[model samples]
Target: MLNKYPLWKNILILVVLAIGFVYALPNVFPDDYAVQITGARSGTEISQQTVDRASEALEEAGIAIKGIDREERSALIRVTSSDDQLEARPIVQQALGEEFLVALNMAESTPEWLQAAGAGPMKLGLDLRGGVHFLLEVDMETAVEQRLEATSSQIKRELREERIRYLGGDLSDGNNIELSFRSEGDRSEAFDIIRDRYDEFLLDESTEGENYLLNLSLSEQEIQQIQDYAIEQNLTTIRNRVNELGVAEPLVQRQGADRIIVELPGVQDTAQAKRVLGATANLEFRLAARQDAPRASTESYPFRDEPERTARLEREVIVTGENVSNANQGFDENGMPQVNITMDGVGGDLMTRATRNAVGRGMAVLFIEFRTEMEQEVVDGQVITREERVEETSIISLATIQSTLGSSFRITGLDSIHEASELALLLRAGALAAPMYFVQERTIGPSLGQQNIDAGFMSVVVGFILVLVFMAVFYRAFGLVANVALTLNLMLLLACMSIISATLTLPGIAGIVLTVGMAVDANVLIFERIREELREGVSPQLAINAGYSRAFVSIVDANITTFLVAIILFAMGSGPVKGFAVTLSIGILTSLFTALVVSRAMVNAIYGGRKVESLSIGGKLANV
Candidate 1:
């Protein structure tokens, strides 16, 4: 009764093993080299016909096809190899046209039944899958300056609304928003405005001869808060953009106060990765030039959607991009392409006040982009790599305000629905609170990834075989049973990992190897206990039951402590360490299950019901 499993316990153990087997079956099938087709912009969807066309294009190119699928806003086509996938990109692109994006990728070929059962292969990490990694530094100065400019613009408008006069647009000199007023009354009013509405700022007022000078700046605490928010917002925005790249597993997170780290697994092209993830663009709402005001356009003052046209607008900005809370692409009442924009509280308040008395006056939505291009430079007789930040601005829409606009507004005059959709995507992703340039870029080649995989796999296989042989030879029949349980434990671990879509890195592989050894450790403890009981002249039934019962404490104590360590590691670590912690944790749990539940069930089946005078666990002498 001690080591023997009841019918329900037996069923439970068998059921868990069966579930593990079911889930782990998917990994047997190999993934296919694939090409992904999607709109270059976010909102563009791929149709079934598009998938068919892609398949046809592959066929016309004399490329072998495996399968195809129509996804939410994208499509995928499967091929036989990476070479085929690379070859098929241009062919598929030509068929889909220039606007549609074609990217080479990998598609899992797990069977439908397996997928329906929530079974899939483990997600590979960047090192395992050969991808791009970038370290980006946020331009904190730009962020602070932009905030100052917006504050200056808002103050200028607020004063105008209150009938308080200020000389020229409020100027920002890095540290302060300098406001010069003609009267002491105006300066006092500005200080009151700063206190009441802009409580985050500190105001300093002085007399510059006949004029009252007020310098407004954010408090130290406020500046620190802004910098922190800028980093976090940039994290969210970068994640949104990288996801749009259709990456299977991406890491986009803040590294420090002003830096972010981006890791994309299975992304092959460096140029495409940089373009999609690193390209910086945002929007600005400015008042258009009036008839009485001088309207001038230069070649540089161009429209983004329609570059042939030039943007003519006043110098003052109404709203910078940070306050955009949401954006969606849709047709207007008259069925014109437009992007509906929604603002946060500050932007809403600013827009309402800025346009309150300016109805019938034109407003321009200008798209600003900072593009980073790497170029070689000669410095001190040495060739060095340098990044050039080229700034470009274009007006996408100019419309007269029919009503006083608040947080929610729309930008019309887009050339096509595609342009509107892209604009909406830009707004939805939000403008970068700060400009970012890649400080470090690394590309892991596919060959090296494959080599890592081979080495990791070989280590696991070799460890498994060594453990298997030892268990079989030392424990004899009982050793073989432990080995069986050990194998099933591995299966369960992999199944759990797949179910969670966990990313497996090299450290994860090392965790699995560690699990393999520790898994058998549990069995060794139990087997030794049984041998000790046999030497004490107990019947085989009594020995088996007592061994399992008594060994349970040691197994639980050892595994639980290790599991706790894994939890701590997972909580405190990042990247590869976290992956290692994940596998170790899961492995500990699975190993315990195999030792207590599975190994016990096996021993009970073999020697539980009937009493025996002897046992054959690679040990001989038992009294008859």
Candidate 2:
């Protein structure tokens, strides 16, 4: 039976298929592609009057305060303003700082098409997202000193618990302890009494004249072990904090034995990141000075108001940050910003005991120290005081004792909306470990990104038009069919890209250009075969069928090899290179299907089972 179909009918079917694919495009994009409005910082130190004044100033400058969240030590104000103006940043900073410390958190606005397009969620890189990166160098000397102090404390605690009474130098000072013996016989008895007790920690010992000298030096292997443990501990602390940031993919790894590298891709404020990362997390709970202590004792306390004194009273920490299990930003009873914190089981027990004992006494103060630069002139001609600013430590809080130090508590001293917000975020994110500091920073303007997009579009348009012209001019009517197939091929490619939500880079445009050239090659092969068959006196229908069937194998083989190469490139590539590979692979697949299936279907329908006398292969047969 001879089956026939109209040429227009086949063309209509092809057009419908292309439109259907394009319509399905939005389904492939992600649903939750918009940027989220993450919460802000707060504090108690800031007066309400100052906040109102700052708000008025911002309004006067045309900046809108979108939202406000308060914390113990600061306030977080979500503001709508231009992020890139050099003049705007300083104006905002000065206006806010006049009454409170402010930290700005800025992120790119969400694209409007994100929801409509249903594209996958956008993942921002470190460069575009602005966050903190740190390379921490561990202080081995400090670690060694800490170990020595711990060893001494342990020895004293054990002796006191055992009720041992032997006169010797103090272990706390790392000096020789000479036992006071009643006689030579008592000396031998005292030596035997402590020998077995100190066996585990004792190093090599020898008699030095009238006393036995016991060495306590740690071995090289022990020191190395201590260093390794410190590095691991630091890494663990950093990982915990980064995880708390709610970031999608953060890079945290050990660079070497004593260093670590941390990368936070979408962090908006580098200063806050630095604060979190630079915190030592070394928490301590210390008893406040007794009111009955002598005036002489008070004078010796490091913090003194004396003009001649350089040292000040060092506010001792009662509980350290290590015991904290969770931290969150929240409002206190009066709507002030405060960081709510919970401690682990052991820490809870210790805190409970400490608070119970100190409940009626002076409140335990939380002291937070951070390094900053300050300029000072020589007070006297003889003294060499500051020209270039140097690092100085400043206290962050002086909260009144309202409740006992316990398992749960809040820290509040927020001066402005922004300061409070950042601290809350940092605490929730986890206090970052020390040694991580920024080495480089950069920011890209959106204008530049837009310009790149425009240039890329023009290049692709020019290249595609040139390919379309060459194909149509060289192959006449047959070339027109090829061009239609080529157009469909590009449409399908775009549909697939939209479906996958792949980011298109400049190199990806080049891949698309290459695909256009390759798509025409398949049609040229089939057309030349048809011309050859026609010259030999075969009917147009038979020549077309023979041409398609013979050319199919070669076209499939060539495309399959190229497809494999693209896949390999994608697997091994990163960033833009992977983008190029993805577009190129999509192009190869779409071109093959359109050039073979689509073009052949159209030609078959046009000729049907009837024989034609003349068939145009576009221009000259050689042009094919």
**Model 2: per-residue Cα lDDT over 1-624, one tens digit each:** 132446676777678565636444443442211111121222236555555655666678776666554444444555543342322345545665533334434432324464454533334334433345667666665566455544544444344455553334233333233333234454444445456655434444445466544445555767677678777777887777666556534667788677777766555454545555555434333444565664442222222112243222223334455567777777778887766778788668766765675665543223233333435566656655442312223333334556667678766665544455545554444432232333334433333343555576687788878877877887777788888888878777776775665545567777878888889888888898888887777776677877888999998999999999999999987655676798899899889888888887766666657656666675333211
Cα RMSD, model 1 = 5.0
Sliding window of 10 residues with minimal summed lDDT for model 1 = 292-301
What C-alpha lDDT does candidate 1 achieve relative to the native structure? Answer: 0.82
Query: 1-624 in candidate 1: lDDT tens per residue?
Result: 555677987888788889999988887776677777877644567888778887887888899988777767767788887778778988998998977888766677889888887888888888886788899988887778877877777778778878999875455656578889899998898789778998887888888789888888788888888888878888888888876666755778777678999999878555557655777666788887766674432123587656798756887787877789899999989998999899999899989977998999888887777767789989999999887878888887888899999999888888778678667777887788877888888876554676788899999999999999998999898989988999899999999998887888999999999999999999999999988888888777777888888999998999999999999999998878899999999999999988888888888788777766678887854654
Clashing pairs in 1: 3-545
Each prediction's whole-model lDDT (CA): 0.82, 0.57
> Candidate 1, TM-score vs. the true structure?
0.80
Clashes of each: 1, 57
* All candidates: TM-score: 0.80, 0.51
* Quality of model 2 by C-alpha lDDT: 0.57
Q: Which candidate ranks first by lDDT, i.e. highest?
A: 1
Q: After superposing candidate 1, which stretches have Cα over 4 Å from the reference?
A: 1-4, 34-104, 170-180, 183-236, 239-259, 269-276, 285-304, 309-319, 324-344, 351-366, 375-386, 395-430, 621-624
